[model samples]
Each structure stands twice: as structure tokens, then as C-alpha cells.
Target: MIAARILDPDSKLATTRWWSTTTLPDILGVNDADEDDLYDAMDWLLQRQSHIEKKLAARHLTEGGMALYDLSSSYFEGTTCPLAALGHNRDGKKGKLQVNYGLLTDDRGRPVSVSVFKGNTGDPKTLMPQVRKVKDDFGIKTVVLVGDRGMISQKQIDEIKGVDGLDWITALKTDAIRKLADDQGPLQLGLFDERNLFEFTHPDFPGERLVACRNPELRKLRAYKRKSLLEATSLELTKVRAMVGRGKLAGKDKIGVRVGKVIDKYKVAKHFVLNIKDHHFDFHIDTEKVAAEAALDGIYVLRTSLAEERISTEDIVRNYKNLSQVERAFRSMKTMDLKVRPIHHRLENRVRAHIFLCMLAYYVEWHMREAWRPVLFCDEDQARKKTRDPVAPATRSKTALEKVHSKTLADGSTVHSFQTLLKQLSTIVRNRCRVPTDGPNAPIFDVVTTPTVEQQRAYGLLETIEV
Candidate 1:
């Protein structure tokens, strides 16, 4: 059986409390394992997971709603972790310990489910499964999957639409995105404006829709960036195109000697952003010449199938940007760095258990982030300058966050209920009170005092965790 235990050093039952100390006294008892170690504890957890898995229903809501989305990964230093053989390490740390995970969440950033893959998993490849998992497992009846362009593909879009209740909003590359700008045809100047809605809907997926959303602010920003990019691309194309046949400038950098091919390839691609005003068939270029290069930048297209009955475009677009909330959850997972590399365990069971802990830890971390979000990244200094009050903004800010409601898990205590109890528990610290003859180490007395408001809140959250 795999071993497991409560490994947190600060916990009351910690036998290896000193293990986290970076400079250890010596390498003693390094390889020891007992019945009460992590592996055994893992067995119990797996049983719990299996029990949870059994409860997952088949043919669950493959159709529906609020599919929050993002990806995460871990790296490995050794070849032991099967998911570690690198491919598209998003973190750019491929040569180290790596594993990647993609997840879907609800409006509150509560994960619906997760899928793990090798660290090299491409972000685009992750889209379909993430959408499907929540649809199938969580009884999600109304799906509104939102992601950045890296997760968009026509095939992936088609897959989501293939399901009845799903919708999405994904960013598209600017060049490819330009198709939606003026409805691609003779629009009388007054036709598209503030109260008017322009829609392009597909017959096969009738609910599939694209609406152009460009505020003056968004447009001005895009215009400025596009001009800068076109200028830069032209300069690069000029320098590269200038180097003709077998010349030192060309061969000095090991450039392939296809003088005709390089210039021809380069000239056509630059036209996506640098097109003369009358270039008519530019939409076709997206499928052909400009696809790959356009993707190199983050220009994204938003596509959604959510029926207009449920939500409007502005809210959909705004909520979709909140997908970054899921992205941040994944970022925090990697940062805890619980030495989650090498993944030395070879048994499939251990790997599953190990991942489960990371998942559990992910829940806790996400929960905490939601709790402090109102104040964490907020600039208290500027906020104070604005003469603004902070309390009401917690509920009012566009930021949406909530932890999965939990009573005591295992023992089943409600979080609020236990929070009250833990505030009563006290911690004792040693302090030196020297009278002339005392030894170098002074023994401290138990200091039972009132809990600070913050400490009471902290302990209250922990009290909900059943042993």
C-alpha cells in the first residue's frame, strides 16, 4: 500500500517538523517509512477519491453553463513521472519537473473538474476536454466556456457547439479578427451604431454567434498597437528581404538560401496587417497565408454559442475576461512548489494520490485567494487617497469569488461553525525572562489570551477541516 500522513510541518502531529528547514543538521532517517507515513495516508485518500468518483453521474449535463477555464502544469527533473515527457511546457521550464493540468470552473472560480496531462500539453489541445468534462460530470446544463485565443480552434468550437447547451467566447487573432469589423461589406454609415446589434450566425450551429465589440477605448488601443506592429513587421521584412542570394549578411546567421521563397513568403504574410485599403479577399488569407504568423501575437477572437436569451454580449465579453481568474488559480498551484518534481513514485496509485493532494491544496489556495481578493491586489494606498470605503466594494466589485461551501469535511462541521470554535484555541511562544541563575534556554509559560480577530478568522477556516 502507498504511504501517507499529514505532512504539514506546522501541524500538531508533525514528527518531521524540522524537515522543511533548508539547512538540516544531517541527512539522517532520510529513507525511512512506517505504517503511518504519507503512502499509507494516501491509501485512505484514494479510497475517498474513489468514493467521490463513484458518485459522478454518467450522461451528466453535457450541454450547459458558466464554464470557467484555464490551464496549469508542473515539471519533473527525472523520467519517472510518465506525464513528464515534455512537449508544450507553458511555463517555459520544460527541462525541469513538469506536468500540466487544465480545468473548468464556475462563475465563482470554483473548479468544476480537472484533467491532467504531460507538461508539454498544448493549451489549444486542452479546450475540448475541459468543456466536455464539466458538461458530463457536473450536470452543467448551460455552458458558456470562455478562453483566450490560445484555446480556440474551429474544431474545438465545433465540438462545443456539437453539444446542445454550450456557448463560448474566445479571442481571435487581429488579422483573422478584422473580418468582423465592418460586417465585410457595404454598410451605410448609420446602420451599425449604439442601439443596433449586428450578428453573424451560422446555420449549422444556429446559436453560434459573433458580435463585434469595440469601444472607443478598445479601438484606440488596437489601432495604436496595430500601427506599431505593422511598422515593426515592415522593417523586419525589409531587412530580411534585402538579404538576397549568397551574401555574408544572409549566410552569417545560417539563413536558408531560398531568396525567392523567403521574399515571396514574407511579402504575402505582411499584407495581413499592412494591406492597402482596397484588398478585397483578405478573409481567405486567414485560412491560408496568415494563420500561423497571426497566432504568434495574442490577438484573439471571441466566439460564443450561448443563446441570447440568457445573457447579452457585453456581459459575456466581460465574464470571459474573468477566465484569467482560473489562470491565476493555476499559477498559485505551481508556486507552492511542494517539491512536486522528479515524481519518484512509480505506482499509478501513488501518482493519483499525489495529484489529489495537489488538487486539495489547490482548493484551499483558491479559497484563500477568493477570501482576500478584495484587498490583496488592491492598492490600499491609492484607495485611501480616493477617500473611498472598502467594505461595500467587496460585494460590488466586478470580481466574483467564492470557496466551495464546506461543512467539516470528514467529521462534517460547517466552516462558520468551526471558525467560532478555533478562535478559542491558543498558541504558546517561549520568551526569556532572565533572573541571574537561569540556563541559556528559558522555558516559557502558557500564554492563554484572547484571539486576535484575524487569528480567530484563520483558525475558524482551519477548524472546518476534519482530521
Candidate 2:
């Protein structure tokens, strides 16, 4: 199943037909497996999920280490599955049922375990169980949890504080940051004159530190996007006003509803002032509101329970930023490689097992990418990443940039993406050969194609990996 997902993702029915064309069935010792067999296998895997997760946790997680947790949802195809419901749709599949799941990974973003939840489950609702899973099930005592603001809200933080041996690093929501930047608040624009990152504290968050960051580039980008959205919203609202003027649109209720749709579509209602009457409709940008919002653009504050002695301020920000790695894992599972979305499984356990299978496949792919970094277009100087500015946007190293511009390694060999490299290796195949005259009575032998130098190089890198 992992091989099928990594190689080419499709429906299970297609997988049954697909595997026969490859050596996966032979390699996995499931040559005669049918669709029923695959479904039954998924059920079997789901039964052992807890045991499997414990083993992975033991391998990847350590006491006092950071565990990255994030929740994402995938749209489901059928409504029969109990886990599927209309919830926060991250995939932008309107009017589609989805199943929410949270991924837990170690500090380096190596996936340790995943838990599937009902589609309607709130993000914070999934946190405490994982905290228990790490401390109770995985037997890790003194661990730090890193999650996004939505996943670790103030309510969740209060709950986490009650638990011993558990620490957390998460950012404040936009509203919270806005409060911090208020006239008397600690987060002042002047604080960033010397450095982009500044650490301060508030009495509200006792025994915690807040690291405020300001990225000028991000600020500019946000300003541009806001201007664009405001313009777009204005353009749409103008059409509505024109309709009201031409008598095509009338009535106070109708004008308000039309204006509501326009503001909601762009989600910049706060920046607009609307006036509507029985026969008149007009809207204008509230410049003051826009400037207030623009003041907070590209400014975010990270909150962490860990102390400066245990972890530095920069490291705390970096750990919070590591949540992007989990995001990358989600991207790979959902669309890039695994194609875990639009699930058709009706059984809840089947859905859980399918997601687990995709996670396991990602585990393998992550290792392969790490091992093949020298040959692929991945940066080799990873140590630089650890030492670089945690708040600044990541930039590629000179060596990595060279590979990008030249499209080759030092040996002048072509650099390939992870997918293309795998495709290249797939060309090496095994065939059963026998002379025509001796085919009836002779013993057949497998003839494997000799790998090319490039294939050998790739294989050599992977030889050290222990599956």
C-alpha cells in the first residue's frame, strides 16, 4: 500500500490493477491480493495502530524534546463514513464532507503518530489526547509541545499549565498581537529599530515569554495584498452601487444583503464603511481602520512556557516556525505525492488506516530525501539552517543556488527532483528469462537489469538507510 501511494496514488480498485504491473506485489509477498484483501489488510492495520504508534514514538520522541503537532482536514468523497462531516474545510472543497486529523512529529519533523478525528472536531480539542499519548503512552516525561495558535489557544494553554512536565511554544493570534501593540503595550514599533526580533513579557502570561518579530518584506507583502483586496472589494461593491442607482437593485434589506455578500467575499468588512437605505446604497474604505490593521502587518508574537536557560529566545521562535515542516508533510500527503484526499472508504477504521498508511509512506520518503540530498536539488549545508536568523525568511545556500542555476552537481551530472529520481530508478526491472526450446522443461531464472552509474550513485546513497 505504501509503495502504491508513493509510486502513484489512486483508488484502491485502481491499485489492485496497478500493482500487478509492478514488482511491489512480489516484493511485499502479496501477489494474489485482491481489493477485498487490501480492505481487510487496512482493517488489520487499524487494529494495531496504537501499538505501531507506540513503537514510532519510542524511536523518534525523547524526554524534554519538542513535539510538533498540527491539524489538517481532507475532503471525503462519500457521506456514509461516520468520521466525515461538514467542518472547517482546509482543502477549499465547498459543501464537501471532511475528516480532521492531527499529525505529531519530533523536533526535526519526523512523523511519529497521527490521530484521525471526526470532521467537526475542533483543533484545540485534539491537543490534550496527544499530550497524554506522549507522556502516558509513549512514556516521555518532560516534553515541549509546539503548535500553531489555532491549535494551542489561551484555553488550551491554561489546561497545559496544569499538567507537569509539559511545555509549549505557540504564537499569539492577530487580535492578541494587536492588543500588545496598543499605546501602553510592551510591543512598540520602536522596539524593532535595532533588531527585527525582540523579547518581552506581559503580566497576563505569567511564567512565559513573548518574542515579537517584525519582517519588513512580509510587512510590504501584507500591505500590497491588503491594498489589492481593498481595491477588489471596492470594485465589486461599486457594481452593487451602480445597480442600486440604475434601480436594478432596491430595498434596504436587499442592499444590505448584497453589500454583506461583497464584504464577506473579500473578508475586509472591517476596513469598509457601509451606508444603505431603502433606495440608496454606498460604501467607502475606512482609511483609519486600514491604517490600524496595516500597523500590525507582518508583526507576530510567539509565546512559550520554556525558560531562557532551557531554550534561547531565537530557538523558541525557530521551534515555532518548525510547524511549517508539518505543513510540508500535509502538503505531500494531500496533493504533492500521496494524494490522500477525496477518500471513498466508508468504515471509520478504514479511513484511519488509510491516513496512517500515508504517514508511513511519508516517513520513508522523508528519509529518502534526506539520504539523497547530495544528488537531488536539496541543500547539503543543513548546519547553516540551525545557525541562521530564526525570524528572517530562509534563503538557499550558495552551493544549493549553484545547483539550482546550473541544474547539475559538481560532477556535472543532472540534478533530479525526488519524484524524477524515483522515476529514473524505476527503469531498472527484473525479468524471467528462458530459452524457447527449454521453456517447457527448463528452470526459469530471474534476470535483473544492471543499474546505470547514476542509478548506482543513487542506490549507493540509499544503501545506508535501514528502511
Candidate 3:
């Protein structure tokens, strides 16, 4: 039953109890530690996964590729685990008990490893463990950890430099990186036939440099965004401020609301957020709006530790900034109806088991995305049009073992029994073990399944796998 549970999408085995009838079914041994029991199987699985980890270790993931890192938090109903806490929530579902999850993924979005942070813990601390896990578990020599501004700071930069080989590309907050670009007034390294991406190296920091990609499109986008925000704020403030002459708004607090609220027209206004030591944890717009109707078009600056030689500075800046793929994966994990929410069985052990299974579900979903994303629809309406319907869960697992059953080839009629089919298909291969001089390998085995007739019909769809 546990073996079946491991393969099932829902982790639920067949519902039946042969022991209730005092029938030990065809097994020769007496019951001691029931192999089919969930607890016993879970213990066996834990030990086996540990063995697999120790057996083989040498770049289980691809090299010379970027690793995306992102964090997410999920809610819990009751106090069953130690990690659950009340902290700042990104999903706006804050004040609810939650547990944080940090994920590391290869370039194509396969999960390399994961670490759980306490709900109350800061996101920045998860970086080191993510970096170390990739090096230790997968032997990935060259790594570029891609994260947003939330996951990095000056201390993180110092840590990256101290390490012999680790590169990071994070979005530079307005405060830390604004000076680099601000000092050079509207700096252009001379426009190219296309936009010229510049590679900036720091002399003080050895083996540490920055990639500044000049994205004309991005510049245009930012300019439009800033203009739109300025206009919107001005429009809002105008509506409120115009009421000031009518004596609607009064006192210093009201004046602060009108004066402070408006993005004054002199310069392009942008909110400056510094996420560093003694982090200034508020949104303060940087602009002096003494007059009305101001438009400022500007180029935003992003910094990365990637050397100029490996990737063109422009590509580095562009690629590193697009780490939303990892964030999307986390979003799917939390939003999916698999109910990954923590529901403990009054025991922390069960809680951990539940979380582990949820992680496994996420791993499977990630693999599915890697395979089928190209064929999937960009919109819900588009998806419903193709393939008639969603693929059933057992189609793949079942179709692989269709030969297990035999049909009734009788003189008058033909019939088949479903129980007989499973009986014929129910089998397992003994664990095959072969040790090599280079390294230990995991125990390998084979499994068989008998699909329902409906599953056999949908075999062609599930058979498709992307290269």
C-alpha cells in the first residue's frame, strides 16, 4: 500500500483491509512490523532517500547555468510545528501562522534543493544555505545565485567576496545603486547600432565586478511607468488639493496628506527603499514637487557580480533581473488546490511528513512544467480548447503496464475482471545492486501497474515528453 502511495499523485492507496477478515492474503510471513503501514513505510522511505543522497554526488544538475532562488510562506491552522510563527507576510495574508520555504532551481526550473526558514526569520539569511547546498549536494562548481533585492545586502556582498567562487546578481535597490548611475549625469557610453551593454569592473574588489546592460526598451518602460505614476499621483492630489481652497482640508495633518501625497512636478518622483543594515523600512518618495505638471524620463540601473568576460554586461543585467520564473513556481505551490497547507495529526512527525509530501508534489509539478510548458496555453480559454480536457492522473502510471492482464477469448462471449487484472499486474522487482569503484549507487527497482480502460485511451497524450 505504501509502495503504491509513493507513486500515486494524491498519495492515497487503495481503500481496503484484509486483516479485518483475519486473512493475511497470500503472504507467507506473520505480521510483526506491517510493511504496508504508513508510519513504517515512511520510516523506510526516509532512510532510503538518505542512502540515495550519500551514494552518488557529482553535479546532479547542469553546470555553467544560473540558479534561481526565491522564498515563500504558507499558512498553518494550528500550533503543531516549531517553525510556524507570526511575521511579515509577502502574500498580504499576514497575521496568520505561517512557515517559510526557500527554493533553489536550475536554469530550466528543475528543483535542485530547498531549505525552510522560520516564519519570523529574515529572507536574507537563506542565501548562504542555498549556495552551500548546491555546492555540497550537486557539486556545481560555478553558480550564479539570482534573487531580488529582498535577499541581498552589503553583508551578503561581503560574504560573496569572501567565498572563493560564488557569483550573485540581484536587483540593486534605489539607495545602494542610485549613486553609481546618479553620479554620472544621464551617462551614455555612446549608443550602439542596438543598445550597447556596458561591463563595469570594481578595482577595489578582486574577482568582483558589475554588469550594466543598457536596455532601451526597459528605459522606455521605466520612463512610461514613472510618468504614469507622477500623473496618477498628481491627478489624485489635484482632486484632494483643489478642495483645500474650499476649506475642506484643515490643520498640519491634512496639509501633510495633501502636500506629502502629491508627487510634486519639479522632478520625476520615485520611492526610495533601502534594504540594508538598520534597514529604512518605509516608502519615501525622492522628489521635490514645488510646481505642477512635471515629466522625467530616466534609465534605471541594476548591478551584478558576474564578470564582463563570461556574459555580456547587458545580457547579465537583463537575465539576472528576470528571476520571476522561480517566484512563479513558489506561487503555484501556494495557490494550487493540492492543499499544501499544514494539517498536523497532533504530532510534529506527521506535520513534517505532510510537508515533505507537499514538497514532493511541488517537485513533480515543477518537472511537469519543464516538460509541458511549451505546449501549455498562455490563457485559460486557450487551454480549454486543446486536448479536449485535462489529462487524468493515472494515465501515465497505468499505461506502462497494460500487458499484465489477459482478455477472455471464449467461444460464445468475452469478459474481463478488474480484480484479476490488478492481481496479474501486481509485482515488484528485487532491488538491483551493483557497486563501482568510482562511487556507490542507489538500489534500483521496477514497478508494474494495470490501468483502467479509460486510462489506456489517454496513453498517447501522457507518452509525450519534451527533450
User: What is the RMSD, in Å, between candidate 3 and the native fold over all Cα?
Assistant: 14.5
Tell me which of candidates 1 and 2 scores higher on TM-score: 2
Order of candidates by lDDT, top first?
A: 2, 3, 1
**Displacement of the residue 183 alpha carbon in candidate 1, Å:** 7.7
- For all candidates in order, the CA lDDT equals 0.49, 0.92, 0.51
Model 2's number of clashes is 0
Cα miss at 64, model 2 (Å)? 0.5
Per-residue error at 362 for model 2, in Å? 0.9
- The global Cα lDDT (0 to 1) of model 1 is 0.49
Write the residue-wise lDDT of candidate 3 on 1-467 in tens digits.
32222222233222123332322322434344343565555555554543333232233355666888887777777775687788777666756777777777665455545566677878888888877776766667777778877886667877866665677777656544444544363333343235444445454335655544444555567667766776676566566545654566655555654455454543344442212112111233345531111222223345567766777644565455446667666665555433445343334444445455555555555544333322222221323222321111112212112322322222221232322222332332223344434554544443335554433422333456442
Task: Please write out the lDDT profile of model 2 over residues 242-360, one tens digit for every residue.
Answer: 99999999999999998999889999999998999999998889999899999988899999999889999889888898898999999999999999997999988899999999999
Cα lDDT, model 2, residue 117: 97
Best by TM-score: 2
Top-lDDT candidate index: 2
User: What's the TM-score of each model vs. the native?
Assistant: 0.59, 0.98, 0.59
